[model samples]
Target: MLTRDEVFAVLQTVPDPEVPVISVVELGVVRDVDITPDGVTVTMTPTYSGCPAMREMEADVKAALLARGVRNVTVRMTLSPAWTTDWIGEEAREKLRRYGIAPPGRADQGGFVTLTRARPAVACPFCGSTDTVLQSEFGSTACKAIHSCRACGSPFDEFKAL
Candidate 1:
């Protein structure tokens, strides 16, 4: 049987389906890696409650571990603590910026009380400009918001700080 660290190393090979630039480990979704006598169990939290990529991510995790010669892999989805952009690591944030998607701002500022106040300004990933406008709350994915960079005149997605 593979050790927990060994399983995690293999899991690092699995990339997020939506953002192919970073692995799930970088995305901070793989919460826990448990090794058992039978096999391995991966605990994950979805970016959002109804995120479409969660299913694909789970399958990818399974495939990645199995491809690395580990058998009987299992992925468990948990929402007790919920997912937050704060969980995203620094490396993943840089990757998102390089990919033209604005990395999320402080999660503490953006919460379920959006209607109570204005959303925080999202900086442009390409030009590093704070002058940006919200094009739409919904981007290519529910977890992202569409924003246009005023300085660069470019359209980009802002991963919501949830």
Candidate 2:
């Protein structure tokens, strides 16, 4: 009979192996959490089709729950609607910023950008500059892109538009 908040709290500790700053919940990988009479079922979607970290993330979640004395944890992967950055919470975005990665855009921003739309403006994390350019559509991982800040001459990874 655990509350949703309690479940989220336990899940907060399950970090993405690639991005330590954001948890699976923050990355919007987890779509649903259901506590059944037998166990807990966590339904998740991969950020991308070929996400390599998804396996590790799933394991982390189950292990975390087991550690918390909750056995029979089940991690279910779903892909019908796909995972999106819009699902990320505000607090998680702040954590990403603090971790040096540019947070995803909000409403009226690139958070919902499709391929046909123009790219969104990315501010520099080092000097708060808007004159940034995309170094590569793909960054160290499939979920992010490399960006360079013109104002401060600093390069950083920006969470790619979902």
Candidate 3:
């Protein structure tokens, strides 16, 4: 039987289907891991409700553990407390920038209240410029917003802070 840490190590190898550059661990979706006599149990919080990639992620998690010789894995999806961009690590932020996607800005004390008004300027991932414009409220993903950098004349996706 594998330990919780060992199972986590295996899970860290499972990458997100939409963002192949980062793993589910780096994405901050894996909430808890438990190793018991029956098998391993993984608790996950989706980035958002009705996220299309969630089922694929569940399968990937199961496949990853099974490939390591641990069978009977259970993946539980939790919604309480919700998921916020604040959960993303610093390393993951830099990786997102390098991958041509602007990471989410810091969440304010009032949470998403700012979203009701004008959105804060999103820095360009290509040129690191704050002079960017929102091209569309929707991006490739529902969780992201599309923006164009005036300085670099490049279009990029900003991971909306939630």
Clashes of each: 0, 0, 0
Using all chains and alpha carbons, the TM-scores for the candidates as numbered come to: 0.93, 0.88, 0.95
lDDT of 3 by residue, 32-78 (tens): 99888899899999998899999999999999999999879999999
TM-score, prediction 1: 0.93
The window of 10 residues in a row where model 2 has the poorest summed lDDT is: 107-116
How far in Å is the alpha carbon of 60 misplaced in model 2? 0.0
The residue-by-residue lDDT of candidate 1 on 1-162, one tens digit each, is 887788878888899999899899988899998887888899999887888999999999998888887778889999968888888888889999999999888677434736345787888999989899998988898778899988889999988887
Question: For candidate 2, lDDT tens digit of each residue in 1-162?
Answer: 455677778898899899888888887888889997777889999988789998999999999888887768999898968677778888888787778888877534434545456777898767778899988877898878889998889899987657
Candidate lDDT values, in order: 0.87, 0.82, 0.89
Comparing 1 and 2 on lDDT, the stronger one: 1
- The positional error of residue 132 in candidate 1, measured at the CA in angstroms, is 1.1
Worst 10 residues of 3 by lDDT: 107-116
Segments in model 1 whose C-alpha atoms lie over 4 Å from true places? 109-116
Ranking by lDDT: 3, 1, 2
For candidate 3, the per-residue lDDT at 71 reads: 72
Model 2 Cα displacement at 78 (Å)?
Answer: 0.7
- Candidate 1: residue 104 lDDT (0-100): 86
